[model samples]
Target chain A: MCGALNPDELTLLSRHTRQIEHPSGEELVGESTRVEAYDNLMRGVVKLSKTLEDGRQQIVGLQFAPDLVGRLYAGESPMTAEAASDVEVCRVPRATLERLIERNPALRKRLMDQSLRELDEARDWMVTLGRKTAAEKVASLLLLIASHLDPEAAGERRIFDLPMSRLDMADYLGLTIETVSRQFSRLKKDGIITITANRHIEVLSLAKLQARCG
Target chain B: MCGALNPDELTLLSRHTRQIEHPSGEELVGESTRVEAYDNLMRGVVKLSKTLEDGRQQIVGLQFAPDLVGRLYAGESPMTAEAASDVEVCRVPRATLERLIERNPALRKRLMDQSLRELDEARDWMVTLGRKTAAEKVASLLLLIASHLDPEAAGERRIFDLPMSRLDMADYLGLTIETVSRQFSRLKKDGIITITANRHIEVLSLAKLQARCG
Candidate 1:
């Protein structure tokens, strides 16, 4: 959306926008609170999650660089947005962004495009959460993280750092931490991935990982 | 979006739009096919689903009246869209709708708003599918259907028809037909809902139903 803005619009945006950084594990937006700003993530990752009444948490979605971080035109945030890693975002006041969207068709279209893409991705994740097995769930999460962390090397053998912890991964995949760990060990035993450290993962065989995702 | 359109834009839409009715079981869009037209559901219900390589199907979403049926600006549909019941939709060529969106900011914002709302709903459903039990899942589906079918009577005691069959409900809820049937019977026995027939459901106690949707 920012790419399509004209000089005047860019100037207007700069007037209201501020760059803010958050450390890992910081809550960026609280659930059910009024949305005060529209954030454009410029660096690092964030997780959108909801907590059940009994305290069970589920990571509903993840946002990467260039993704919008808050709901626009809505009164309150539906889920909590947490910094999965050290994060930087361009924060624009909700009212200012709404006014800008009203005046700029290009920006509005860009936002619509982003929302549609997010909706598609969310639905795809629903399939994994609802139907995929525990091992497949772990593989799906790994595949998702790999594609997001290194888009250019999606189908190729590569090594990457995990932005979130194993507990977060287990929550996102809707499995127990032990189950997730077991799956990771099984994958390692089968030579699909190598755990360099707790957070670093080496993809030994992308083909095998993809097959396990099924 | 349609409600905010100007007279000239409405005329332009009317010029190219065609209304079509589909039977209960017709597929509106196949998974991964190029989207040729943008559809607005005028009546009845639609289900968006994805199928796995092993032939397991999971319904990711349900669309009601005035909801957009296909994605805009995307090349291919991510999931298969099928009519959950007798449906009516206003179909416009994809190119035509794209051009109109470019010309109208309100329409773009409306679509963006819709997409964001759908994303929120999808995330909420993810929590249900991932963590909720079988009886809770059935209760959740019933509550969802009742609210959509009659929004004004959501919290009040009311009755509404189920748009889809037991199999469709099972697919959407990520449970077997037997489990879904057993849950329905349990709900009836518990006096949370009264089964008028196989497809008809009378929500006798909205509070009890909500409690069951733990």
Candidate 2:
């Protein structure tokens, strides 16, 4: 997010950051809990989710490298953060980052812009979750993962490991796992995508996939 | 959102603002259209929506008096804003506000905080859209309106005009108009709410209404 940071600012940030690696499925931070560290993700993916008292879950957001994960202000995090894949993070103490942000307008503006972009993304997904058909939802999620995992590969076939499990995908899309799988099978039958070893996905055509996302 | 502005800053803001009044159903901003002004709402409600290519529309956000309604950064608006009721706004030139924000960190932080709050609300609504039942969706929307309309009336009956039409409610909840009407009737039959003139809604018991929001 701090893509505008100068070399001196980068050095200042590096002084406060400590690198850490986490395995998939690790809980980086719990919902409604205070956070002591603000993670600047260097690699891998993270999933943010909220759970109901009865255990129904909804994955609200997915974060990739260069995204920050923690409470921006104070109080407690409203969503839980979990590692969706083997992840690396440059974790900075919350207070240090907060102090730096207060002093550095560049840092403040970068974070603000990032938060606004995330807000826009969240609203877009609201349309997907609320209005999209089940099959469309599945395709949209696939398109999302494909686009983000290999953003530099525009208009090219996408091949990558699915960052999240099928169960997690079901939760994210507000569909049953069976329904998600059925959509995947339909997509495969239509020659739009291929799956191997369950997690590996190869999108045959971005155009065809976009059509399915409708 | 600039609640922390000093008297001098408020004076400066006033100098840059021109009051405007709009009737209900007016389009304050259109999706994908460039905006010359940023509106600082003075009274009434505004509904922001996104429409799909096939004409399916989803209400993404609702803004109240004291909220700003315009492009924060320089780009075409991603959503359409329509007046939910007769509304008043203090309109400021976009360039003026942008310049002021660039020069004032307080204003910047205020907008950032507001944006973050919006992000949280959007995610919360995602959970409602993804997991909550149709009945719960109806109840949750009612609760949201009641709470926002009269925050001081906690633990008491709530009486206010419904801001949006039943059709709009259906769009927001991702339900058919018939389903939304049926749910309202069910709530009325159960003595949880009373609707008059198809617009005035009197929540009989906020506690019972909240219980239904689950």
Candidate 3:
């Protein structure tokens, strides 16, 4: 988010942020609560989700390293945020950031750019959730993770650890755990993706995977 | 979005806008096109959607009066915007707004606020798409429209025209037209809502409708 700022401004903003570490599965922010701080991820991942009153949950977005992790100007967060893995973050006080945003147009623009990008992502995922078949949904999730790790890569092989557990994947995809498992097996059998040790994944042909994501 | 500007600034911004009217079924913005301008809704509703390569489509969002209609900074639009009803919009050159956003902090803040709000709404809809039942989805759509028409209303009767056709509702709810029709009939039979002329609806009990949203 400091990409738009000069070195002096970047230094000024960093001085106000305090470093914090959270273990996997820690609740960093609660649903419907007043936001006190903005956490900028320096390592690992965080999952953002909302739960209905009946306990039905959906993972709406995921944050990776170097991403800012808070809703700005909304006063209260509409979703709960959990540390999806052991993570390090720089916690900036909400007031401090708000003041900076008010005074610095570059800082505000950078944050706005992030917000716009996130909005685009959320809308794309809506299409996936609303219209995609179960198999396509799984492939889309993999494609998202791989693309994030390497934005310009296509038709290339990729090997990485699935950042989310099967249960979390189910929540993210809006599918049952059994369906998620079945899709994984099907993908493996189809020579699209290979699995090892449950969470490890290797995309044999990203082009093939993308074709299936319709 | 001119809400945050002073009178002089508002006039300055208004001077750059041209009024345009689109009848129902007009395409305000095409998907995957280079967006040269932003349309500020001065009149009616616009449905925003994305279609897959093989013809599958999903309506990602709806825009009402006083809403700005276009993606900013993301050079190419990720979705299409179509007029859901007869609409009037003030068209402003995209570059003009870009310049204003760069120079005016309040204008930047206003637009940022809208983006953040849209992000929250999108995430909430993700839960609906992924987890909500057909019945709940139907109820949620009604509740959204009713609540938008009157945010503080509950337990009271509301009479309004359905903004979109049954086909559009089906697309928005991620259900088939038959399923959407059945849900409407079920709601009417249950006395939760009453329909006349197909497009006119009377929500008999908003509290019941809210409860049914799940």
Tens digit per residue, CA lDDT, model 2, A1-214: 5576778778888898889999999989999998788999889889999998789999999988798987598579999999999999989888888878887877787788789888888989989988999999999999898877778886749998887889999999998899999999999999999999999999998899998777
Q: By descending lDDT, how would the candidates be arranged? A: 3, 2, 1
Off by over 4 Å in 1: A154-156, B154-156
Model 3 DockQ class: high
TM-score-sorted candidate list, best first: 3, 1, 2
| 1 against 3, candidate with superior DockQ | 3
Q: Per-residue lDDT tens digits of candidate 2, residues B76-135?
A: 888899998999998888888888888787788778777888889999999999999999
RMSD of each: 1.8, 2.0, 1.8
Error of 2 at B62 (Å): 0.9
Error of 2 at A146 (Å): 1.6
Worst 10 residues of 2 chain A by lDDT: A1-10
Task: For model 2, name the residue pairs that clash.
Answer: none
Docking class of 1: medium
How does each model score on TM-score?
0.95, 0.94, 0.95
lDDT per residue (tens digit) for residues B54-122 in model 1: 988899998888888897788989999999889999999999888887777667667777788898999
- Off-target runs (Cα >4 Å) in candidate 3 are A2-15, A150-155, B6-15, B151-154
Which candidate number has the best lDDT? 3
Superposed by TM-score, candidate 1 places the C-alpha of residue A93 at a distance from the truth, in angstroms, of 1.0
